[model samples]
Target chain A: MRPLPPTQRPNWRYIAAEMVPRWCPASARDMHYAILGCEASLFGDSNAASMRTSVISCDGGVVIVRCIRGTEDDVETALATVTDVGVAPVALHPFVTSGTIHGLKKKIVIRSLPSDEGNYKIGDNTYRILRMSGQKVDLVQQGIKQTTALYLNTDDLEDF
Target chain B: MRQFPADTNYSFLPQGRFVMKTADACIYPYPVGDASLRRLADELELRGFTGAIAVGIPAGCTVGNVRFLSGVDITANSVKSCRDALRSAPKTDVVMVHAGDAVFNRAILGNIPLHILRGIYHTDKRAFDHVSARMAADRGVAVDIDLSRIISESGSRRQRTLERYREISRLSRKYGFMLTISSGGRSLVGLRSVRAFVLLGAVAGLDELQVCEALAAPAALMSPHLSVEVIE
Candidate 1:
């Protein structure tokens, strides 16, 4: 089949979203299906089909969701409804929207945190620092399923 | 344009008018979750919120660019008990009550000095009817739309919540009652960005401006003495 002309092709919009608990092991496929499921559930199959939502990339805790130009808001609404992918509970927090994949990628700043994990204590209970970005610090209780994560900042750790 | 008294909490634009501050009306920190007050404030600032109402915390605390308001949630079996709870509760930034039966809602809307009526999704279908919505509008009490349930719940429960919210949005438009949007977040992970709330509002059939106004409602309610100037 011959490629459709530019005028015939649907205009696309890319939305950049950060997954909460950035360390969660959710793959691109998981995110794609989760987004599609959410869109279908919220807008029904017809509207979801019209939107043409897809997860183009999920790299380093950030996922770029691609959708038709006019349906970016609907896609965002669906993203907000996606509380989990499979059994892992996570949130897709969208920060920016752009017309091109290159433009979306340019706006996303992927910080490189210290590779080595650190330890911290709070009221006799010890927690290992899972990921530190800016003032936000993700912590995991010393012994648990690792599913339970603590979201705290540097100031909160001052007393301990 | 509306009028607001000059205060340090409000930023004064070059036009000599107050800039409506976006605030997340409800958040649970510390004992309720691992997130501390400072951490919550930091998260709010990052999410583009100028202020937030932290349930059970005192008002007048500022961290970074975000300010904290004390919010008290009253849950009672009857109107009399509700009144007693209100009287005993100290002066706070925002007063929110859990929605009750139809009669209870009407009674609270008229008699109480409440800022927000919350948890409507959990109540009976007839809890907040047209009469209650009118009372809320006349009394200047905002109806709280908690998005946390919509985010976390699924299947029938989530559908019910969405239906309830859609009805509330319709009522708000018809009766002119204010709507306040809250993340109802217990931790940083549960909190949402401003744009996210606006999109969620769209899902409930609300326009972007309505959601922005709702985000600004808590701040205006906190300053009862000043008139709220909602930006277009």
Candidate 2:
């Protein structure tokens, strides 16, 4: 074997310090020094564990968080505060017949899953999907003209 | 139609030893092969509830070994249909009808052998009124007060519901008709204790005593032999 150079020599003293006997009762001074060494290693040190950024996607106002291998409850709790404004968690009830979607002149069957730009049903007969900024849908019902809209939670929609 | 238990006593017990003899007026029956009924029975037993009137029980389905004695709920859109249906139905301990149209409500009030009148404030137009209240008082038809509507709704709709409930309460007092408060809940989470119902009655402008009376009304209606004695 070739002899090592002086610059490549191992720190014997440092290695010896780390090899303290487990059976030996640790003295207060020894414990203090050990803690100081640990502090040096842990605080303001580049060798410490690095934190990875969580994968998050926000399209328009719809925030989709990707939690790899996370439980449903954990993900739900993490996104508890972040919700899409004006968009409710309602059931998407498609019309029974495709003709039902196309037949109405006053009522438009939501053709595609509404993007941020699409109109949404707010009541039994009213909608606010035409313009994204408005709160009411002006339409004629039965024979009476009405302006008030009833907003329903997405969870309450039933498929008919 | 199973015969009602002849030995069943409907007397109100003293407080702390109170057994919930009052049946929940309206409960949709569990679907065939569903364990919700069994779970509901277990939950009722745990909650010290005696029995409930199972509404909308599917045809040919048998409800056996439940903790509570069960009754059937019959719903119809018109008075003639309701009458025809009731006449055809097999004899049960209690027969509760869902109040539909104004005509149906009026027709069933005094003429029919109905145990309970449910869904008084379900529609935009009130089905129950002062005239209906008078008929209910005369015929001994107990008005069912379902708490599920109050618990499930909010905002202006909830306000409307509360107003309707208040109106019912007012009419109940003026006409001296029997009133029974029910959870009207489909699940175990919806079932509330008699004490809790009384507290809710307070919110609906009914005194605690009136609430207890309401609870006892069903039992009294079921077994005429049992006399209600209010302690307070």
Candidate 3:
């Protein structure tokens, strides 16, 4: 391969950030994850506790989240609230389909996936990820769709 | 681990370890673009995932053509560059590389490490497509690809999906790659799926933690993480 011309030499900063860490955090990295989005929030239901609907500007998209963990009611009602409501009536989430077995009691079987993308921190040492899961079920009327739910796996929202 | 009782909400893994097949992470190229990556990450987060999606693209192509979905914190957009980086890294450091490509006119199989392949997926689409296709054509590389979890989440007819998998499996196996049963939750994988292929059982479905009695003693013989005491 030929050497890059001075003009064509690409910036190392983009590549450095892309491949490996070039900068260290001011403090030790603590692994923590956030619960984002709910079916309820998708439909413009705003009063879902401490969770707020916001978007990260670096990458643009609106998400349902809590700047800090909220109340249990906040978590309960708001978790997985951003579901697709207009389309169907009784579809189960994907986790349910993936792990749970349905019966009279709506029983589910969930296996912990070793790594959840929701759980990560660049310069931190902690390991946390939102407990995102899915279950599959067919509605007698509407059809099949994935129902999603979220939870705080860390102490940040454990009280909630 | 114990067998999961049907009604229990928390199911036990076949053994209590995450299955380590890199293929378990193989994803189709369409969803890895900028905006989509972030949404995908959020969706994965809401669903409780920690690993990065192995976004495969065709190789030797411009970076922009690959539509990178935005949700991920750090995308590994360089399978091509990792090799150059690795040649100069420390001896113990892992370099990203795929197993096999370039055989006779007929495609063959090669041993690209799973983690390396996973990293490459984040690069450009053409690079990924070329890599997978070349593996199919030259080295018989098989892509156990899938639509993004979002697409899987998006509603679709079961029959249509089943047909799609069947076709994809046929294509992969035709050129010398095996197709694994993924996407659908808890599928009924039977002896029937492995009919004519030159492959074996689903690597993803196996109990990852289960080991033969023989290799067990040796790892225990080693120090640190690999070391485990034998129990009667």
Candidate 4:
């Protein structure tokens, strides 16, 4: 079989998305499936299949998604629909879209890991601080079935 | 690529305040979820929002540069109950009612105190019709298109939501009723960026300009009470 010429090949666009919470451990494969699932649900099977979306790479809390050039808008819209991967609730927000992977990479804001801020108590339950970046803090309250994620800020912490 | 830094204080500066024209009309902060109003304001700033209406929080305060307006949501099952709820609803910047049946919607749209009609996605298919749409337009009551349901729901549920939103979008185009966009976020992670809302709005058949106008509608809703001053 012979490879097609560059002009004959399908043009692709890359999108850079950052997973919320900064602690979601979903890998590139997980992100790929999540995007596919969201696209399928939002655009239906035929439209989603025609989009030809895939995960190019995952670094830290960011994932680079590649899709057929003209379908960038559809892909970005689908990415907004993805609320979770596996059982962990998360949000994948696309920050930039570009024709070249190099250009997309340059536009990706470098994500940093959330550091331990401190512990806080509200009423009867006690929560442990999971991730703190700037004014926002992510707290985890252990429940019977799953952990409850509490998103708060420094001012709220001070009130406690 | 326009993501703001985590600590970016969108407008809460002592020297100068950058008031954002765009605001999320509705979000439930703390008690509903662990995210406090201040945290939600900060998250909105990081996501490019300059102001928001917190359902349970006190109105008229600026947190981290993002203007915070108080709002009250009435979850009633009937028109009479909705009217009663409105009568008792605490004084806030915005008052919204969850959509019910067609009769309920028509009755509530004409209410002078109602500022917004929300939660149309889960209502009956005929809940909001041409009559209600016309009434809303005439009354200047905005219809809220919540993106949180579109973002969180899937399968048949998501399809139904999109269908409802499409119907509302079509009606708004024809009737020229005001439309408001909200995340209906319960936590910080649930908040979305303006671009995200615009893209999600497209999924519901809203154009870019429509989405931008919807985002800015909340600010306009609050300006009607401003005192007039002579510019001369």
Q: TM-score of model 3 relative to the true fold? A: 0.27
> What lDDT tens digits, residue by residue, belong to model 4 across residues A72-125?
888988888887787777887788888899898788767577776567787887
lDDT scores in order: 0.80, 0.47, 0.24, 0.82
lDDT of 3 by residue, A1-160 (tens): 9998966742211000000000111111110111233423221345433344222111011111223222323332222222222321111121111111122114222344323344343233333343322321111111145221222222222322
Residue-by-residue lDDT tens digits, candidate 1, A69-126: 9998888888988887877778888888999988877778866642437777667767
Which candidate tops lDDT? 4
Task: Give each prediction's root-mean-square deviation over alpha carbons.
Answer: 6.5, 25.0, 23.1, 3.8
For lDDT, candidate 1 versus 4, the one ahead is: 4
Model 4, CA-based lDDT: 0.82
Docking quality level of the chain pair in candidate 1 = acceptable
Q: Please give the ranking of all candidate structures by lDDT, highest first, separated by commas.
A: 4, 1, 2, 3
Interface RMSD of 4: 2.1
B1-232, model 2: which lDDT tens digit per residue? 1111222222222223223455555554344211145344443443335556665443212222232434566788877788898888876667888886667788877667888888765754567878888888877889888876655454566467667778888888899888888777554335554544655566566877667778777666665443356998
User: Per-candidate DockQ versus the true complex?
Assistant: 0.43, 0.01, 0.02, 0.66
**Cα TM-score of candidate 4:** 0.89
- Candidate 4 regions off by >4 Å? A1-5, A117-119, A142-144, B6-20, B224-232
DockQ of 1: 0.43
Give interface RMSD (Å), model 3: 17.4
- After TM-score superposition, the amount by which residue B228's alpha carbon in candidate 3 deviates from its true location, in angstroms, is 32
Chain A structural similarity (TM-score) per candidate? 0.85, 0.21, 0.20, 0.87
Q: What is the TM-score of chain B in candidate 1?
A: 0.86
